[model samples]
Target: MPAGSSTGSLLQTLFALILVLAVLGALAWFLKRYGPKVGGGNANVRVVGSLNLGGRERIVVVEVGNEWIVVGASPGRINALATMPRQDAQHGDHGGTNAALAPHSPAAHSFADWLKQTIDKRK
Candidate 1:
C-alpha cells in the first residue's frame, strides 16, 4: 500500500476508537447516575419514599433482614447518614426481643426506648 494510504487508514482507525470510547463513557455515566433504581427487589428491603428528578422518579428500596437492615428513603430522596448493626434474626425474631408483629407483642418502640432505658437503668 502507498505510505499516504496507510497513514490515512491509521488515522481513521484512531478516530473510530476514540468515538467508541466516548460513547462508552457517556453510557457509563448515565448508568452510574441511575443504576440502583432497578436494584431493589428483596422483600426485606424497606422503602421510605421517592423523588422526581427532571421527569423521572426512581423507586427507592432498602434491604433489611436476616443479618442486615437498610434504612433509606426510596426514589433517591435521602442519603444514608448512619447505620446500626443488629443481632441476626432468629427463627422467632418477630416474637423475640422486638415483637411488634405479635398478638402478645411488647411495646412498639421497645428497641428505641431501650436507649433511654439503658441510661436510666445505668443510674
Candidate 2:
C-alpha cells in the first residue's frame, strides 16, 4: 500500500467517526427539547404525598378526580390500600389557619403517621 493512500484512509475513518457523533448529538438535543412529557401533562391525577416504607416499598397518596387513593407500591406491584374523598382547600382550614400549615396541629401529622394511625384504627 502507498504511504499517501494509508494517510487518506485514516483521515476518512476519523471524518466518518466525527460525522456519526455529530448526528447522535443532534438527535439527542432534538429529543430532549421536544420530547413527550412523562405524565402527558394530565391535570386530573396528582400525587398528594408519599412515604417510604422499606428498601423498595412505599405508600403513596394519589389524588384522582375528587378522591384520594392510598396505594402501596413495591417493585412491580401497586395495590390500592384505601380511598377517601378529596379534602377541599377550604375544609383544610381551622379558624383562619390551615391545619397542614400548622406545625403543632394534630392534622399536621406526616403522611406516614396518618397511615399508621389509620391502620391502627382498623385493628
Candidate 3:
C-alpha cells in the first residue's frame, strides 16, 4: 500500500476506536444512573433503606415481593441479616419508607437491637 493510503487507514482505525470507547463510556454512565429504575414499578425488589456502619460496611433493607429483608453488605460479601413481612407506611404504620425504615434512636427496629432480640428469641 502507498504511504499516504496506509496513514489514512491508520487514522480511520484510530477514529473508530475512539468512537467505540466514547459510546461505551456513555453506556456505562447511563446504566449507572438509570439502570436501577428500569425495573421501577414492576420490580418486586427495591432498596427500602441503607445505613453505613463503616468505610465499607453497611446494612441495607430491601423489599422483595411482600417481604422485607435486612442485608449486611460489605466490600466483599452480602448476607441476609433478617427478613419480615412488609409494613404498610401509608396507613400510619411507623415503618416509613426509605431511611425511615430504620429509626435513629436505639429503638425496637434498630439493627443491633433487633439482632439482640432475635438471638434472645432463639434461646
Clashing pairs in 2: none
C-alpha-based local distance difference test score of model 3: 0.73
Off by over 4 Å in 2: 35-40, 90-123
Residue 81, candidate 3: alpha-carbon lDDT: 80
Question: How far off is residue 19 in model 3, in Å?
Answer: 8.5
Per-residue lDDT, model 1, residue 93, is: 57
CA lDDT of every candidate = 0.48, 0.72, 0.73
lDDT (10s digit) by residue, model 1, range 1-123 = 699999999999999999999999999999989777665566766533232334544323233563222233445575452233433344655422452322332334544443344346457
Model 2 lDDT, full chain set: 0.72
Model with the higher TM-score, candidate 2 or 3: 2
All candidates: TM-score = 0.34, 0.63, 0.53
- Candidate 2, residues 14-104: lDDT per residue as tens digits? 9999999999999989988898667658999988767788999998878899777889999999999977666555556421122132233
Kindly provide the TM-score of model 2 when superposed on the true structure, using C-alpha atoms: 0.63
Q: Which wins on TM-score, candidate 1 or candidate 3? A: 3
Q: Is candidate 1 or candidate 2 better by TM-score?
A: 2
